[model samples]
Target: MNSKSELIKFEEGISLESGDNLSSFELMIETYGDLNDSKTNAVLVCHAFSGNHHVAGKKSNGEIGWWDEIVGPNKAIDTNKYFVVCCNNLGGCSGSSGPSSINPTTGKIYGKDFPIVSVKDWVNSQNMLTERLGIPRWLFVVGGSLGGMQALEWSIAYPEKILKAGIFAAAAKSSTQNIAMNEVGRESIRKDPNFNNGDYIELGVKPKNGLKTARMLGHITYLSEENMDLRFGRKFQDSNSKVDGKVDFEVENYLQYKGEKFTENFDANSYILMTKAMDGYDASKNFKNLDEALSSVSSELLIVGFDSDWLYPPERGKEIQLAAMNNNIRSSYITLDGRQGHDSFLFASEKYEEIIQDFVGS
Candidate 1:
């Protein structure tokens, strides 16, 4: 697929859900395929936490995109038939305005001073981007995990602008356990000495340890016990060596490598902000319940949850499906049996590729 990334600046900026305003801001977007003449075949693909706009195809640096497996020519998303657009969210570290961005007012990094952004705030900013692109409405908006929440918000916030929403491995609200996990991650970053209380950038330092620890913890929740056992199975990192209380297991080494690799590309402040945003999202908060929250939604929904996903299990997806049905909206729920846990949507894409293609095609 032909893909390109661009940074678009909006001088008018946007008002936040918190009532604050950004004087000016930018969005980093990557788009694939050709936009048909009627502009009616555009699909919006939202990214999960720690994800950016590079959703599909190869980048200039020869790095393949995150969702390339599911979004290429004649793939599940079918780039040959539809234009796919993804963005590094408003408060993201990847080329977008965030704590790492220079504050237009103070002429300094926003750091901890960056206004807290919500899922709704992200949808509002995305609306601006769609308007700029001259897309009156999207054929569909699809995402996994946090991206799924954004897809949910898009249908709620702008019912007229979307025809369908694909919510994969996500829930309508953050579970209590999920909130606790996020807090632990946030505290890990704040406690790092080099964090400097969110001002590490100016000090020419980074909270690498803290961020690495947080990533390691989060990674555990992303995989299922079966997956771990299958991959590691208490295997020793080195068979020739005896346990000396220094990372004996293969799992330990793998987690460390993943965590260390994460710190190199992601910003600590951005990680904190993104998790908090995810934790605070509750679609049913403004209404009586999930049913009422989805009452005004005009978009059809395809919600899929992994059976092994304890983070956001199949029941969570069922809740959204039932709520949509309660409001007389068309919805489908799928409980995919997989050992990949929360990440089954990506790792087990082949198992449900036809379902996705049919959903969009219908």
Candidate 2:
């Protein structure tokens, strides 16, 4: 459980999907375990929206990472056997080059000027990191949610560079409903007077309220209706405050708390950028159909979905599996029984852990 974080700069510059060249950028990464001399026992873990490079272990502040439960020694990923590397994506706010980072030309934060980034762009940047780290190939590329999209892209984008991939709670493309939900969250921030059109950082302010509201909306989708009923039901936060109609429901209080906490660490512009990337992700976009698109993926694949995850339903996972099978790729599909919705992949359920251990160990 020794983990360390570092920043690696790409001085040669990165060419983005938008046709813009980033003069220079840095990626914040965390690594656990030793990279074997052969450099073949490496596993790359991609983080979801709002998540950073701190995948596991404690930070300098003694705060545990978002995926601490699933990535430590003897955990599903088994850092004891594999070198685990997780990096904050380029457009992320967590110690990575992003809208909040200083632009070399203007000497000011990129802010709204940050170029649009796609899942392909993220994969390219990651490939650079892999080269810099001297890793010949990733034994496995794993991720859930938006991170899952990156994992899926990797299988196709770099078929020769990965041996296996684990994709959880994700689809081949964003559904209409998915885009709509992201649009609502983006609008929430845009309408906030404090947003200042993504230039809030230079305005010497943060769009706290707007960011909080957007996070609340995003959090709702992360959970299922059954989960909400089971966790909070119709209970009131404060019985006496029911008369005022202010934060009456326990669920409202929970969402409010989550929103407030998110704004404290996440940047508003980064949120906008990440969601847009999600909206633009389509693994089959370049091909005539999904099966054709997947035909190029040579990696062993494991696709997992939650039974209660309506946002990215189990059907979507099956779609990926069927396409992989049609392409003659080795693939496995499982829909875990859970009411945790899209967030089930993040939970430490015994069954989920076993599934991952079996897949990665295989």
Candidate 3:
């Protein structure tokens, strides 16, 4: 993939959905391929909650992107044919303006004082970036999970700016169960003594334990019970290391490893902010019904769901498709057979890839 990561500064600043205005801010973005003369071949790839702008390249640190499997030269996204752009969201911890960033006015980290950003805010910021890059419209806006939420929002908020969208394992709004799980994760972070009320940065400390616990809990929802059973299956991480009549299961070890790895790359405050954004997301909020809300979308839609995704579920993807179709929007829905649950979209399944290749290539 011919790609490079760069930072874009918004000199005119951006106003948040919460009525706050940032005097200046920066967004880290990664781009692949060259924009056509008309600049219409641009594809915007939105990342999941914990993901970053490094969507399809080997970074200077030698780390590959989270979605490298789906976005290289001959991959589903096909960088050789389309100019792909992915940005670190404004409230992201990964080289973007967020709670960890120093406040221009206060000369200290924004921390908890950072205004709560919603999915709409993120969309607006992305639009600004697109305009900055001289792109008139996106050929496709694609994402999975929280990224999918942003794709849906892009269609609703800026219909004229995109030709089509691909939303995978996402919903029109946060379900009750989803909100409950997010709340639990938030509680885990808040209860940690090192959290320091989200001001840990000033104290020269990080709420590592809290963030680890939150990631560990959230990870469970990303995979299906079937997957967990088939992969871990009551196996012990170390059969010889039993303590207090209990042995550590392989699953426990896996979760711990994931949690530790996540904490090493993510910020606790950003996690809270992202979950809040997810909880507050509702595409139909101001409309009478979902169909009415989606009536304004001009883009063709492709919604993909995993049969075993209990978190977002196949029914949710169907709801999005139905709403779009009822409103006379061109739309399609597909439920791929997979036991990986919500994270199935990230895997390199040939079926899933073929579906995307066909949709975008067509």
True-vs-predicted CA distance for residue 95, candidate 3, Å: 0.6
| Model 2 alpha-carbon miss at residue 230, Å | 0.6
The lDDT per prediction is 0.91, 0.92, 0.92
- Model 1, C-alpha of 311: deviation from truth (Å): 0.5
Candidate 2 per-residue C-alpha lDDT over 163-228 given as tens digits, one digit per residue, 9 for 90 to 100: 999999999999999999999999998988988889888888998888888899999998999999
Q: Worst lDDT window (10 residues) for model 1?
A: 239-248
lDDT of 3 by residue, 1-362 (tens): 67878999888888888888888889999999999998878999999889999888787799888899899898998999999999999889989899999888899999999889999999999999999999999999999999999999999999999999999999999999999999999999999999999999989999999899899999999999999999999988876543223437888878877888899889999999999999999999989988988988999999999998999999999999999989889999999988898999888789899999999989
Per-prediction TM-score: 0.97, 0.97, 0.97
Candidate 1 residue-wise lDDT, 159-258, digit = tens:
9999999999999988999999988998999999999989889888999999999999999998999999999998989854422356779999888879
Residue 6 in model 2: shift from native, Å?
A: 0.4
